[model samples]
Target chain A: MLDTILSFFKKKESSKDVAKERLKLVLIHDRSNVSPQFLEMVKGEIIKVIQNYMEIDEESLDIQLTKTNSEDGERMVPALVANIPIKGMKNAGR
Target chain B: MGEVIVITSGKGGVGKTTTTANLGTGLAVQGKKVVLIDTDIGLRNLDVVMGLENRIVYDLVDVIEGTCRLKQALIKDKRYEGLHLLPAPQTRDKNAVTPEQMLKLCDELKEEFDYILIDCPAGIEQGFKNAIAGADKAFVITTPEVSAVRDADRIIGLLEAHEIRKPRLIVNRVRADMVKRGDMMSIEDIIDILAIDLIGVVPDDENIIISTNRGEPAVIDGKSMAGQAYRNITNRLMGQDVPIMDLNVSEGLLSKMKKLLGFKTA
Candidate 1:
């Protein structure tokens, strides 16, 4: 049937996968007891500190709470991952 | 002493009362003396679900306030030999009974019954506190939906905070067909996220509604899939390692026919 042929070309990612990904992200923040506002405040402070040493792109800065394996790789732990794009380095002898 | 078990779900309408009714009845069916205490206070309905609404002469409030003896408030279910129900007062709110009172009541009931099942009200409030006050074990019920599971996670945190460690989870209203189609979350997916021991998974079935309408629990019906699921849960509660029921066996005829025609159902 045409439907069966079309199905072969369709995206394989199901909604349940999307739900799992979303739940993982939400639960990480929930378990870590960090609110979006709290993360934003922390980001602002980090930006302020980073600006003292280097020029960074605040618009494209990405910060989020995610899960990462622990040192022993036996447990998953909450991690604060941040991507701060450095534009330029500030003068050292200012 | 009898074990006090609290049935709780953070979200409303996730089958907490129904689970309580069926499990309590199922335990009695297995020759265990059981008592189900509805702790929803003003929104009490376990009595109706058990078909004991008209027999409630005295309620939990009466026993707590010393208006009646504990023995006077316990309603014996004629259908089940060892089953009894302590209905909540229809007129009173959650404040009518305190955690201390509930603890005392559970202590008294433990002396008489083999299993004391408390049906906890929804939300993390006074009702929830009172229901879990005397529970030696807790069963956290949840559906596959995101909101219900999120609330259940919060409840698990609260239960551990209250020293009710490692509360087992019961996932209700699971649709096997939906899970097969990758649309609904499966039991494994829910358990992975919640990170709790799975006690049981009940498929969504019309028999639950039919039994509720008749003021009788589905556990009494031999043919109902949900009833068989409850029987399995009861066996697990009694320390028997019963395997989880295979939900796919009850697939609808249309799906079976579709598969027969060589069509991809999922």
Candidate 2:
């Protein structure tokens, strides 16, 4: 109910905004030369590794290939960043 | 030395050839000796666009292949004393001429012409490589659409990799009415994403199609809005600071309705 009220107050995104957002995401993948399927595979592996020790919120996990400026600000380097949320640790009750 | 400028757009049907034809004519009108090279092999249209298709006895491939001299293949435009065209061979594919050959050709033409404008073929392939091979500068042409802009970004990345730094952009076929309504991407929006220096923004005009069909580039028509835009771009290219065209169509439906209802608007 609160989210709906806040969203109603927010300005509607134009088609240009949607295009820019989509292009930004697609370009990140293109510049890194990483396929979406490959990213999904990597995400699956990461989730499997974490599942061995902890209970993770799979729905909240986010992984993406992005860019960062080099130390001297001369070059843009592609970086793979991931965020995985944890709900609880396995065997905590034991 | 002459400046070899490649008009390239990664996606097809964006107006690279039209820009090439207009810029060639525009620069020549400014008393600059200009030569337009059609590098889009297997799909040659520059000659047709320039209305010099019937005069092609020899082509770029023939010059490179040593069958004909460079001068023999260059078709002189009837209107301009300085403007010339080295058309692509419609029969041959892109593999017919190599990048090294294109570089040598540009070197030879540099001595005679003030500007050598190469019309690049679509896609990042061998044809594209050959087009940019001899170019000192590149003008990326793209529309306001998402796909064209995305392709332009990719082309820009490739240009950077080839060490062709400081590429300028030409935003082509922009609809003023659509932009006013936020239905189309504005020049500012495109420039913000592309992160390149803007040379000019050409407004979408119906007259361009008419002029193109007649094989006379719109830049020659003083009455054309698109022609004025091209002329401004030409002046800008010659190192003059020309103002961008005001693309706001003032007498739109809203204004008409307001006028009918007697509501004065600013």
Local distance difference test, each candidate: 0.88, 0.86
Task: Give the clashing pairs for model 1.
Answer: none
Question: What DockQ do the predictions score, one after another?
Answer: 0.41, 0.35
TM-score winner = 2
Superposition TM-score, candidate 1 onto the true structure: 0.78
Stretch of 10 with least lDDT, candidate 2 chain B: B257-266
In terms of DockQ, the best-performing candidate is: 1
- Residue A24 in model 1: lDDT: 80
- lDDT tens readout by residue for model 1, B129-167: 999999999999999888899889989988998999879
Clashes of each: 0, 0
lDDT of 2 by residue, A6-76 (tens): 55644576766767766666676675562357788889999999898899999989998777775646446
Flag regions of model 1 displaced more than 4 Å.
Answer: A1-11, A34-94, B249-266
- Which lDDT tens digits does candidate 1 get at residues A24-62? 867877865723577888899999999999999999999
